[model samples]
Target: MSSFAALRRAHADARFKCIFLRPTLASQRLGCPVSPFSCRLNSSTSESHVSDAPTEETPIVASEKTVPSGDDTLFHKALTPSGRRDLADRIIQDGKELHKLNVELKNLQRFARSTELLVKGSPWKVAKHWFATPFKEDVTLDNGVIRVGSQTVPNIWLRDNCQCNSCMHQETRQRLLDTFSIPEDISIKTAAEFRTAIEVTWSDGHQSTYDKDLLREAGANSEKKAVIRQGQVDIHLWNASIAESKPQLNWEPESRPHEKRVDKFIQGVLQRIRRFGFCYVNRMKATPEATEKLLRRIAFIRETHYGGFYDFTADLASKDTAYTNIALGAHTDNTYFSDPAGLQAFHLLSHTDGKGGASLLVDGFKAAEELLHSDKEAYHILATVHVHGHASGNDGISIQPYKGFPVLEHDAETGALLRVRWNPSDRAAVELPLEEVGKWYAAARKFDAILKRKENEYWEQLQPGTLLIFDNWRVLHGRSAFTGKRRICGGYINRDDWISKYKMLHFGKEDVLKNLAAG
Candidate 1:
């Protein structure tokens, strides 16, 4: 018999004695005589029960007829004080044994379930002792594919993604193996499925081991792939109504007891920014240093030609319209750059002699959706036509992407909107062909109208000590003209940096980062 079978047999015999023999033996020791009829019944039942497997219906102890009394009172009264203590200890010991048996039974059930899975087949199994069977009659071991239950993984793919230390760097987690060196028609020499993992020896004699999780991922279907892609950040589109329920996080004091507040604050801010594209940090110190420090929590500051971590008054110090006290319309900053800033933060440190410089924010995504539904032709034009922008206000400096980009960018595979680049002030000359120029102008007007709608604008006169951070790629920000010495302190963060932080926070420690890290 197998070790498991031997152990199971031992448990049954021990349990039967503990359940049926303990009462009779303890009663006889305490001077409660066993009647002749009880002795014959016990002997016959015990002899026959030795071969009978213990089950839930098994009596916890011998029947009361075996004892010289009708109830347990006579047996208890017959026991001395020392005997009573011994009896109590015996009960506890038996209880422990019963618990162990119950645990072992549960393990046996799980083993049976896993065996059933191996026989019937499953797409994926997370059991401790998992096994894989061949997928079909035609699928053999030496073929180019290895079957794990119902899933099939190509030999080349398995060899290329080997997680061994020699193939993948342990510290950096980057592939060191030459993926191209492996033959396109590679085949498996042998495959062995162990209790916990599958091992495959390639035709070239290179071995690779895959755990259940890795195996499942290697054979995931298109539906599962879509779910995995869409599982990250959930975008919540909003218009003016978002102003009523502003997404904001309160700045907590940096005391020892409240140290965890920093983590909560950072997570809350990132989650809100990801969902709504903007969030406010209220009750901050409002200093340039403080704002920079808080922003660095998410990522390093993105330096531009103007400066990094800039703090300036409305003095035109940078020779840009944003440095002046003019009412700028809804537009995204740095539209002229090849890769615009990902996140932008602003804090109204002080605003002396100012009355009407309330900041305006518009959800470019919501406006784009409106355009898509209201006029498909205009949306198509905006999505297809490329536009150029420039930042040449500074002396001896002109920045622009080598080629123009579309106003509405989208993910090719998912057809989901990815970015919006719109800036009327910094827009360069229209370089479209004569025939398409009119169509582009009409599309531009339609988009501009949707952006300017009253209900689409979210206005707020940023208060002192409050910091407002928004996604520059999705939320268009501007300010009303004012007459005052308004000083603002803020900076931009690189898109890739903040996105990395958000993914880490959202997914925690998982294989979701394997592809992200490779990129």
Candidate 2:
């Protein structure tokens, strides 16, 4: 039997005497009858009798009869010297047993709650004894699989994920034990389940305790695991109509230590950028240093060939068209990078003597989705064709991915579109077979046309003190032709870093690992 069940059984068999309290003089004045402390204590399951006036030695049998008020004689039933001593001894012994029973019950409840939450998404239905101490009959080991409660897990995976302090650094959450050191033919010597966790002893003499929840999650499918890691942020794909109600927030300078006012504002900025692929932070100081400080709140400025936290005018300092007074088509930045920048921030510090430098944004993911439904073949070609992109405009700055990537990239496991790498200006020569060349160009042009469509573009004349941050993977950015100087300041944030900040803020630090591990 489980320890909790045993404790309950023992408590049920014990013959304990409980002293009942009747209404005192004070309670009588308040018009109260029997006090709540007046509880019947049954020494045995069988019914018994209680005399009109019983002595302490006479068992305090269960009775519903209420003693008349002011009957002092019945209230203070005299106890013999020997009876008083016996009652006191039994009271002390039963109190200790009762405490033990309560402790056991509390532990059992905690185990049940934890186990339920952990195995919530499991395919197998949990049996009643799921929280009990697992025995030989409850578990099985065969063909390198350990089956417990109808759920099977690989023996190697279970051994590698040992949560013992010797195997894993508790504070750092890093694996101290070498995974390869584990035996390839590892076997379980013994396995036992408790209310909240499972204990396994390996044939190699290493022991580990695995939480039931972690086990279920590790055994889950790929798509469910991805959801855990990415969280449930609703992505709102936008078109030109988004201009009527843009995702934006107002920035106010922090005036005091640990000020709570800016907490909501910062969270608002992150949520907007995450959901809509971009957000604008208005009413900030129009300076390079100020813009850098704001970007640092999300993550450190990511340095590139151009610079870290850059501030520039139309001076061609980087030998790129972006540094010229010309209109650029909608395209994602850093297509040449293997792991392109995740987020890009832009703050038009000043645009004096400029007529039309309206910033343009196109939702690449939305456009890709449209292509997938409207022209599946075109979408497939774009997703499959590996496009070579490069940045060789500046001296000694030829940059390209080691392996070319698709213009429309999707996650291999989930088959969900993840990134868009489209920058015609920076694309390298087509390296495809002549027969496929025509098809590739046709598909590319079709996607480009979708991006440049009037209904797909959201344009705004960015003003000084209005900062914009966008996801470079999902949003294609461009600028209209301008007349004179148009000063801008911004920088890139690495994909992993910005996403880390978002996950940390969205799901607290404690849960970030739980989700990431599942994925």
Candidate 3:
């Protein structure tokens, strides 16, 4: 016989013996007549061979639930061994519980949908009936309106008095009515004829219904007519135009008479400072006369130690002791002083043979603005936290400490930004309640990340005869280390001086103090 035919006959013989010969009594009870050949083979095969076939067939028997084995069902045996009956029972119970939960969820969803439909049908009416009724009953209305209590609402609700963008274009500041004045002659034809919603007939005779609450909010019942002003001054204009204007740097000698071009340049620089809090002046000789001329043009000059005309020559013996060799990071100079110098002026006398000295300026105001937009809560924490700085180790002079000023300060009356605190290295640990310390650190980190951004950086090499001036409070200045000799003559001029000079040039000889006080 062929090998495949032999294997098939072997499998058939094994199945026949297991079905008919192994369970002779059971087969006989069911009227399944055992074949003689199957009985002869079962008797000839070893007991082990017969046991293997019967074990395989027993699994099939358990699968059909024909025989109960220790109360375990056939489906349970299919999923797991018969020994894990408790586990199978738990799984079945869990399935039943999940089905019950699904039914409960469907019932809740149906109720929610029904409630949403009822509320959306008449949202305003429903809200008024619920919250406004008790107060409404206490208010009274004259003419077509019945007396509810003390308050009075007009029967004719105004449809045109809406604040939506469609009715009032926010960008253009245009309202539905160019002249938003209430109608002068409003008359009720009959008390009974007037409904809660009076049809509003416009000048063009088109009619629309308005809600009673909306009309009251728009001052419909007031005796005085409402007129909306269209062209109010926008405060954002001052700060918004800072980045719009081109920056300028004026360079002229103090000894020479002010030319008309230089005069206009100084005025522009001052105006830029007032509007944007910073400006730059370039291309002038770094002589004491040139530096003084620029400083004098400002309102006031703040003199520091080793004052007057000086040179930054690298000859260790050079007369200029004011200029130091130390490389500085971004910082407002003299922050350790009581009233930190407001405006800083630097004149590059000579950078002969300097390999790597470049001046860097950063707008602290812009950095703070970015922080406020990203996370207002973090911004608030920074504004509330107090920071302290000191330079006590080397210098014998102890500077007055600063307190209670916000990193991003805004004017309370005008809502204009006033100052920024961005010194990281020198910042002292602030004493706060233990709970608030963590939040303060988080806010400080956010502010630092924004200040360090490359986009906010403005860098330029201070060539010979270049003078740059900026608001010390708003602009943080720094420089890169130099390989060769680099020299710079720098000093401070107060902001009040700069502002006075700006006002004198722009608004003629008008007293700035008088104007400021008036404002």
- Model 3: how far is 20 from its true place, Å? 98
Q: What is the RMSD, in Å, between candidate 3 and the native fold over all Cα? A: 25.9
User: Model 1, 1-519: lDDT tens per residue?
Assistant: 533243334445444544444344422332212211122224323333222222334432445544543556534432344444444444445556555554455445546543443453311211101212211222223344566456566667788888788898877777899999999988877778665567888888888877655565445432233333432344677899998999998888645325356766787898798778899999888799889989998899988889899889889678898999989999998889879999999999999975789999999988987886687667766776688999998899899888888898764433456689999988885666676489888999999999999999999999988999998989999889999799899999987777777766665646554433212
Candidate 1 vs candidate 3: which has greater lDDT? Answer: 1
The true-versus-predicted C-alpha distance at residue 400 of model 1, in Å, is 0.8
For candidate 2, write residues 1-519 as lDDT tens digits. Answer: 533233333333332211211122112222222121122322222222222433334544434454434553432331233433343444446556544554455445545543442444211111112322222224444453566557777778788778778987877778888999999989888877677677888999988887766666665554455543644355678899999999998888545425445555666787788778999998888999888988898888888888899889888678988888889989999988898999999999887875899999999988987786677667767877688889998788899888889898865554555789999999985656676589889988889888988999999999999999999989999989999788999999988887777777766777666543334
Q: How well does model 1 score by local distance difference test?
A: 0.69
- Alpha carbon RMSD to native, model 2: 28.2
Model 3 misplacement above 4 A: 1-246, 252-263, 304-327, 393-395, 402-404, 429-431, 511-517
> What tens digits encode model 3's per-residue C-alpha lDDT throughout 1-519?
533233234444434433533333223232212211122223333232222212232333333223333445433333344423443344344344444544455445545543442443322222223322221322223554533344443432332443345555645534665433545443334333244544444443434444343343333221111110100111111132344453666565445565676667788776666545566676676576767766776645676543443445444442222244555666666544545677777777765554776777777766666775687667656655666665443335444366634565543322335566656555565656576588788887887787667776667776667667777877887777676666666677765566556666765553232222112
Best candidate, TM-score: 2
TM-score of 2: 0.70
Worst 10 residues of 1 by lDDT: 122-131
